[model samples]
Target chain A: MDTATKPQQIRLSTTPSRADLEALKIGDIVYLDGLIYTAREGVYKKVIEEGADLPLDLPAESAVNFHCSPAATVNPDGSFNMGAVTATASFRFSKWIGPWIERSGARIIIGKGGMTSKDYREHFVPNGAVYLTTVGYGTGALLGRGIKQVKAVHWNKELGLAQAMWVIEAANMGPFIVDGDLAGNSLFERENARIAANLDKVYEGTRPAVLRRFGETDDRTDEVIG
Target chain B: MIAIETIQETAERLMEKAAIEIPEDYLDGLRTMANTEDGDLSSFVLQAMLENYEAAKQDRRAMCGDTGCPRWYVKMGNEARIEGGPIALEAALRRATAKSTNEIPLRPNRVHPLWRTDHDNNVGIGAPEIEYGFEPDGEWIDLVTVHKGGLFGTDYRMLFPSDGVEGIKRFFLDSLVAFGKRGLACQPAIIGIGLGGSKDTCMVLGKRAACLRTVGSRNSDARIAAMEDEFKALGNSIGMGAMGFVGKSMVVDCNIEVGYCHTGGMQMSVHAFCLSSRRAVARIHGDGRVEYRTDPDWFTDYQRRESVEWTPPQSLSKSA
Candidate 1:
């Protein structure tokens, strides 16, 4: 490991100020404090598409929305047991993210893979939001340890445990890498560009398959996500 | 005879082990990658993962929140007999799966594909698939459970004989590069390639190659073993590491498995056992002795034999 090039780390609240977000670079690391909530396609469709009322106050109470489903269960006694908490891939939620950010006032979106730069520029920049990708696409046990409490759960009966909204209080909860900044700069995109430069050399001996599938791209620069 | 109650009890234990413990082979592989990885952000990710595994074990928690879809591979010696038979054995496995899901608090990941009905347990229609294999030996059974991530990092392609090894390499790179972007396929993974079989078997072979085999294990055939070594190097050389960052740690290891296919066509499938490569194995003897270990050792010489007739190895025959 290169100690000299290690990224800087900071502690920030879930409901962070615009200045706090603006100061963060794409490669910096962050650990979160305050309240965060879990939401994904199920929550998005129910609230945004079906027009369900917001269950909790938005940025006033919490501004971090995690694209995650924890290894959790509701016990017979009605207490929640959340074992490990990790984020899901955020790019899959691209369709709902714009509206979600607008309605929920989410200042920090934590997830597995960061969304595309286009998404960051369009949805996050205008809203003063940034993206934090979970380390290892997880660090679930470490993140789980940081959970001060499972504050509440919503829509368990309607959507089940995996899709229901889960409110949690975090205390230094992360090892999250800043994938998108307030300026819409993306760490993944920068890394991709540098890695792309070596593709031709690495693929020198391999030949393309004779039977190519439809919608396949020969261009190495193109991303798989839409 | 192996008792049904014993089977279920052992299976439940296996589930917990698979979820919480980072197998030694995979941990060692990642440790090696972490030491050599120079990409700053990627190195940080690797170090955190190392800590995460320790935390999981110490806290007795699942390593990843996405605990993945639990499945089973049962290999029984031909002389073995169960208390109730195959039906009872299956029920025991399913019962163990559901019981562990709640006890371990695994994210009930399985649901009806269309209806989206979640049982709140990992068990559902065709969920926690159980596959069977047999060996011509003693009265003990080996149970292997793998909680592999269900989504992403696997693909199948069909190529004619004319396509050759270069074509195979192309498809392999395509899968890695495509899913490797932003670490969707979760690189620094155990990349498994199934070279031949019908399409469905190709997928099965590839999946087994990833989940059942340990890191540094090779295919029995010399040519295929060589390809395994080469592919591991090729994947690491892609200039990508954990989370698709710029580093040379994309592949921890590569494993290849092959099956006989149609003469004119070659079917191929690729699978990645991710950073949390969760698998556990146990052997339960008829006398009630149960031993636990990480290695599945599923692909024995008999499992890969090409001969039309069964012939005991000289050593085994002499011992008998």
Candidate 2:
């Protein structure tokens, strides 16, 4: 139950309310809810390359996506148990993100890791999709919020605990921010810019590009703000 | 000195010691992980362990209700001779069996062979094993007590190949398949993979090591580290974050121990600790005097409550 909407077909800001967007800027917080279908690296790669069957079939306009895989818990009947964890990230499969979101109706990508692209701005914001990030290693607390229901449409598997397709109905599951907003800006983008600018000075030209942005903060730095 | 006793007495003593000692290890390991992870979840696990320990101490109860019957491993000292004890392993262990079942804790598990609920540990004839170490490590009667945590309904595992480049491609699919069945019992886990062991050994080794003293430590090898990095990344890539929520870093550190063999056989053991990671360990001496270990107050406090996250140390030591 989804309808295709191209990025150009929709115009919205990071914050949900129209008035809230009127006074928004970078570093602001936002929350998204409502029918977000599920997909992971398997589904993303398939839609991009293989055109394989998908777990859900939903629209992208204002829809959200998740990057999580939860573990198991004690079953109700005292039998077996497992977690409905989130997917990881939406970036590594960057090649297909734009095309698929354009085709499907998903507009937000919820993940924990990092994703980067050269034409990210034009590809994401101009197309009405924004990138969101959830707290890492906070599955138990997130699930403690209590799920309303689980939708199986567009669900995907093949990534295991690290990746699974689950349509979870979550309320107030947040403190997550728009790492990438509708205007082609993101934490990945800004970090890449700073890295590019400081490459010769800070990294000494010998640092592995992969070493940037991952556990690179000074020891005296703050303990995870927000 | 007390008069010489029969073989049953020796096994009985050993069995008694195992029950107490094994729980100590479980408790201490949880504390160690709590000490290092410093995350909100680890804190809760640590807290529960401490509470279990305290509950046992306050009333001299078993560290935990389960006190999973010990896995008895023995080795005959080169010069040591046992004239009075029961020769067979099982017979000897039964004498030392606990008559005290003070609220024996029940785990969310079932018997594998029969696929039925058997909580008492007394149901099966050879419920646990009596493997002997071949090494002549001395007559010191080294009773290596293993704490068994997989209780069936809660711990389901499978060993599959490391998915190629698509990054956790196969595992994600399998998990989805599992989700389709809605058969998993816990949320948030610490996955341990033992690569290269002969099928059963690989899984057993990984799981056993996972329950080893170094619960919070990273994998010891580099190649395995690479796999962990990928799994974490791939899991993150696929949005397998939070406890089933659209978050990040769902599977904590996937601890894998590698064993080399002439032929290739890989085994991956997945034991879901649930959000609770309910486990404890105790080590008992010949006299049945037990020495206990586990995370301190703050860590233990966090282990019980989901909202708690304490700052754990980078290195692990008993001092914690």
Candidate 3:
């Protein structure tokens, strides 16, 4: 494998259009600079299921919504003390992602882990959007460094931080990878399949030692996915 | 007698510390991975995490946004008595949890199941799960709090008597391979494998192993210790990096704890904790002295050893 000694620095607009997203291929190391919005769990459900409009006016093409519920402390004066902010697993919010993309015209979805392969093939690819994973480390550190301001907070009292919208301005932020590109490619799905294919051989090599310990039959199927 | 108020204060401090600090051994493991790894992205990510930890410590801020579900493992001294009595300790712990949520500004993650109400305080029915154990003749009450948060699902399993060690290994690897695809289930994850207990016991053991054990610490049983070594090697060999980017270090440690089981069934569980493993420990003396600790010292008795690196095959293919 060719090793990447240094991450390629590509600057992306905070608000990316469909064409902007489609231009970006899988595996492009990017540094996002501009404004991004935080929305997850509650916001997605409310906008898609409860028929509420997206709390912000991010245009579809350049819109970037990170799946995070920032741990921001509200001051007595109603300001926020933005604390540690990081991404959560995206698949749990998979159902609402497509709808949010549709309604809000969001072009990029960034979070930890990744979306399902089906979401990549059907929703992301067709919508001309890409799924990116936050660089796992220093997410909170990035907030401390990259975030210049919390532009606005919406629906603060009713939903609190859990469902509130925080418009944030960031600079030279993100070393995010395109785990799922607009071309129906998924780095996550492909690696999993390759690893699964090799499991039998690995198991076969260790079968004898296992048999010696516990008298087990050879006819066994391993199903990992529920 | 330790006053209930003192216990409450200690519990609150414990929760706050766990939210902010990464344990020493776990931090050491991360630094080792960051320094030794050849992969660029993985190294960068690891270094970034280290930087984040330092920043959080200096700012007195939580290390991560998800300040997780509070899982408390309490050790009660046989001779210990509290001003409000024994049952009051639980109440103190609960109050501490709520107080920390507001004080530390922990994200309110606890949601009511049926009504979909967000308990903005991280408190609800049965919140801040407490598991208690008694230590005879001990002089101080000790508390170890593990804050659990991540996206990967299903942590427990019940094995049939027919399924052997091979089956157990397969389950562990398979679950990993699947979760790895859906996003790195917190890379360089610490996997706690519990074997042979009743289902419930196995689940608890699995959690304890993940939360309480030090990285690179071995099980007391030689066989289980050897298994820990083997699993660590096998897991890293898969080449799943920090965030599924394909690197040499996938699992930092795999701790296995086993218990005797009924003949009818062999129960097992796997609890996976991410590299940002957060926990804290505290001890309160009968004389009102309190000592707060970052290291749980869960594996103090188990010997620590150098990590053995596994080389992947030359023909290894990566997706990225």
Using DockQ, give the best candidate's number: 1
Candidate 2 residue spans exceeding 4 A from truth: A1-26, A52-57, A60-62, A72-87, A117-119, A143-146, A153-164, A188-226, B1-320
lDDT of 1 by residue, B11-116 (tens): 9999999999999999999999999998887888899999999999999999999999999999998898999999999999999999999998788999899989
lDDT of 2 by residue, A1-226 (tens): 1122101112233224424333333333344445444566556666667776544555523366665433322234533232223234344566667777676656666664334534346566556666665432223333323334554433222332223455555555443444566556655334333323322332121212221344544321111211
- Check candidate 1 and list the clashing pairs: B188-B250
lDDT of 3 by residue, A94-201 (tens): 778877877777778888767776787778777777888777643664564567777888776767676777788878776677778877787666655545555565
Write one digit per residue (lDDT tens) for candidate 2, span B75-107.
344434443542543554543332221112221
Docking band of candidate 1: high
DockQ of 3: 0.34
Global lDDT of each candidate: 0.91, 0.39, 0.72
The full ranking of all candidates by lDDT, starting with the best, is 1, 3, 2
How large an RMSD does model 1 have? 1.5
Order by DockQ, highest first: 1, 3, 2
Our tally of clashes for model 2 stands at 104
Residue range B1-320, candidate 3, lDDT tens digits: 88888888888898888888888888888787777776666676777678788878888888877777877878766788778876798888888888788787677788777775776777888887888765544567888888887757235656666667776777676556555554446777788888877888888778778888878778867988999999888877766667655566677788887777898777778877876787888888889899887656543321122235433335431200
lDDT of 1 by residue, A1-226 (tens): 5576679999998888889998899889999999999999999999999999999999799999999999998888888899999889988999999999999999999998899999999999999999999988568899999999898999988998999999999999988999999999999999999999999898888887788889878899999888
- Give per-model TM-scores: 0.98, 0.39, 0.86
